[model samples]
Target: MNRPTLTRVLVANRGEIACRVMRTAKAMGMTTVAVHSTIDRDARHSREADIRVDLGGSKASESYLNIDKIIAAALSSGAQAIHPGYGFLSENAGFARAIEQAGLIFLGPPASAIDAMGSKSAAKALMETAGVPLVPGYHGEAQDADTFRAAAERIGYPVLLKATAGGGGKGMKVVERESELAEALASAQREAQSSFGDSRMLVEKYVLQPRHVEIQVFADQHGHCLYLNERDCSIQRRHQKVVEEAPAPGLTPALRQAMGESAVRAAQAIGYVGAGTVEFLLDARGEFFFMEMNTRLQVEHPVTEAITGLDLVAWQIRVAQGEPLPLTQAQVPLNGHAIEVRLYAEDPDNEFLPATGTLALYRESNPGPGKRVDSGVAEGDSVSPFYDPMLGKLIAWGEDREQARLRLLSMLDEFAVGGVRTNLAFLRRIIGHPAFAKAELDTGFIPRHQAELLPPPTPLPEAFWQQAAQAWVRTQPDQGLWTSGNGLRLGLPAETVLHLRSRDQHQVVHALAATDGQGIRQGETVYVRWEGEVHGVSLFDPIAQADASHTTQGGLTAPMNGSIVRVMVQAGQSVEAGTALVVLEAMKMEHSIRAPAAGVVKGVTCQEGEMVSEGSVLVEME
Candidate 1:
């Protein structure tokens, strides 16, 4: 078949994936067009593109997820093809169909293929018909609580409820018993509806101690399909993958071939084209069962690329242009071990709630042969609450798993982000854990080792105080012997008392006139990096300290910036501690604001549908 004239391509997404795809497309000599929401007008992806289209909305529903807007952007930009870089509308069958109807190439599977596997329930049914082993559960079209309750009871306790229309742990919940079934189902459905515009759900048996292993499959229009080995994405939090490694650690050659072939068969069943991932729940005793199929490039694709030395994005483009598979199944290469960790702007200590703020100080790890940092934001960029909290990804490749793991640790240590809290330290602890080093991985890895990985905050050491003092001293105007402001006397070096504050802790450090330490001063705050950790230290001010000391003893506040989706408390209602008072939706996830102590609700400061900022009191108790 003659190659389709594909000189221009438009990316129908934003953030790291958009930047990632545009880089590959530009490298392939194609003009790249970027579509962005109003808030992302100056985003990295928009700036890097050869052409830009403004979709004109901050929320995804009005921009990225709007099929009409994306298609219009592609048409106006005169792009020949549209690449739906995963998330948003990547797996939406309607989006694929719209692109096809608009006379443009969709750099993904056929619309029919996506429609077949878009719904987890439908995908499982198709997998069963293809003779792929499945975990026993109910995947029928039933949204009622009673149906799910019955299914859970029949499938035994501990079931996983998932959104049929999407992945990414957005609409997924694990119910441990029958009593938790109704609430879990309702919450899962709400998240599903908000994310995919579909409230349909499926209940499946929660596999005990199962490893999440997935195979990357690729195909062209000519019916040639092959699996590009597997990745173990077992290290997860909240059902979202945290760490992923290529070529699952303990799989034998025979087992690898078996899973790979099964994944290929599953893909062929739907006439899948372009890139897709077939996920499975692998248990001890070599048993693996199909979980679902993601009909788009996965977030963890970098690990597969690292091990295979293949640019999956470039392949997606070529395949979309009607080319055949680049290599046969036997010719596929698996060279070395590779690992990837997601860098999310979230506070792990606060139940991993997403954080939003300015990127006061952003520094990526030094580029090298084996290290790669794929990020979308730069220093001074704002991390808004309107999108995913992930800032970027850190990927490392090495000759062995240990080398790859250590390299990733070093990379995480070198990485630093300020203003917004992040999971960088948590990721480092996970990678550096002895259990992870031994490859004792599973879906429960984070929860199992939570004590060590999520340890309580320790008091800042004296060395850190000294460093802060030195950093502060460098900011002084005068540095001469006679005019210095370092408590300078006639001859003796006098101690300068420096009052500093970090978070809620106040410190008083005394230091002599000395040189600066490793720190970056941003505004009134100084960020000091010590032993792989970044500490934000601010000079103590009486007024600011007094303002911070104002107590909210009986107030329940929003933990992050989001819209209030539900208010479960009234002004005069009484509640107990831990009672869910309000549900705030942010970054596509819901966070419940619970009552701090048993008391009567004195006031409901926030109403449903109101947008609130972090620390905004939602409910006042008395």
Candidate 2:
């Protein structure tokens, strides 16, 4: 079969994936055309493309996901192929068929393969017919509650209720016992209807302590297929994968061969082509069951790329153009361990609610030895509420899993983001935990470490002194010294006092200045010293409340605002030091204010429904 060379390709998506795909296309000497929604006109991906086409609107439905607009953009831009990067139209069979019919190439699997594995229920049936080890469940069409309830009861307690049309941990719930069945069903149905336009559900026995492992498969038009090892996506929160690693730990050579064979069978069963993923749930006892197959490239594809040194996007494009598999199954070698952690614009301490804000300061740490940051937005981009909360993916590679874990943790600590709350610090702690280091991973890891993960906010003591020193240093004149209107303010004082407020805690520090020297203040109490300059403070601990007032020694009022999301304790509620006292929802996520020390809830100042702006007082604890 003769394949036409793609001179120009339109990337039908936005953000990091678009940027990632464009890199390979550009490297292959193909002109990259970027299609952007109105709001993303100045986006990083759009700017990187050879030419830009506007998709007319910001919302995904009107722009990125709109079939007609995307096709029109490609046609008008004189593009030969379209690359739908992962999310919008990436797994949509109809979209792929339409693209092909429109005299343009679709850089992914054939439409038939997408349709085969697109629907969860339909895919499950097909996998079962293909002799795959499926989790015991009811894939039958019994929508009535009585029928479903009876099936769930038969399957035993702690069964999983899932929406048939879509899977994302959304429209899904685990009923621990029979009494919670009705509520779980209703909630699942509601979410399913809202998410996928289908309330049809399926019930399966929930796999406890299950490890989420998925195999990456690549296929060509010439009936050739290969598996690119496996990724363990067990570290999850709210059923969403927070971190993923390739060559899943604890997999013996025997088990690796078995799972890889099963994955290949899954892809071959549906005549899958291009890039696809076969997911499985591995139990504590080493039993594995087919979960589902993602017809599109997954978000964690970087980990696979890191380990294999094979660019999956480039392969997808090649296979779509009727190219044969470059390497056979036996020859494809997996090297090095790789891990990817999703960086989200979220506050982990506050239920991991999504956050939206400008990228006040987006800086990737220098990767020492083995670290890679794949980010979408730059310093000035706005993380709008229009789509997924994920900002980017951080990938690390090492000769071994432990080295990879340590490298990832170090890189996370070096990440500094300001202007909006992020889960960077939380991710750092998670990667360093013993359970994760040992690869004793499971889907329940986050929930299990929920308490330890959110112990308390520890404000850096140096930060307070640093800020105070800066304020004091700025008070002196560049030439000599100037008085602050009062006669008592000209020369450097023998001693200076500053009061700093951090959430519910107040502290006072005293510093003595040197004559005409570095503007650092040295004090006797706690052997405090300040270095005149400020290092990066954006990654500092979050300001718990916007309205906290501290009686600083300098007597300056803190700028604080925002309504409280939760008051952890009532008036006179006794609490220990570091106990969460209140929650504030600001900039699209939640922020918890904890007690600085053991104290009673002296006063309750804010109500639940109250609208707070910048500096509203929330609670007072003694």
lDDT of each: 0.89, 0.74
Measured by TM-score, the strongest candidate is 1
> For this target, which candidate reaches the highest lDDT against the unseen true structure?
1
Clashing pairs in 1: none
Query: Candidate 1 — which residues are off by over 4 angstroms?
Result: 475-491, 547-549
Q: On residues 105-153, what C-alpha lDDT tens digit does candidate 2 reach at each position?
A: 9988778888778777788999888788899888777788887789888
lDDT score for residue 622 of model 2: 58
Model 2 TM-score (2 dp): 0.79
- Candidate 2 clashes between residue pairs 3 or more apart in a chain or in different chains: 499-552, 546-560, 546-561, 560-614, 560-615, 561-614, 561-615, 565-583, 568-581
Runs of candidate 2 with Cα error greater than 4 angstroms are: 141-147, 165-168, 177-200, 367-369, 457-622
Tens-digit lDDT track of model 1 for 237-350: 888888999989999999999999999999998889999999999998898999999999999999999999999999998888888988999999999999999999999878
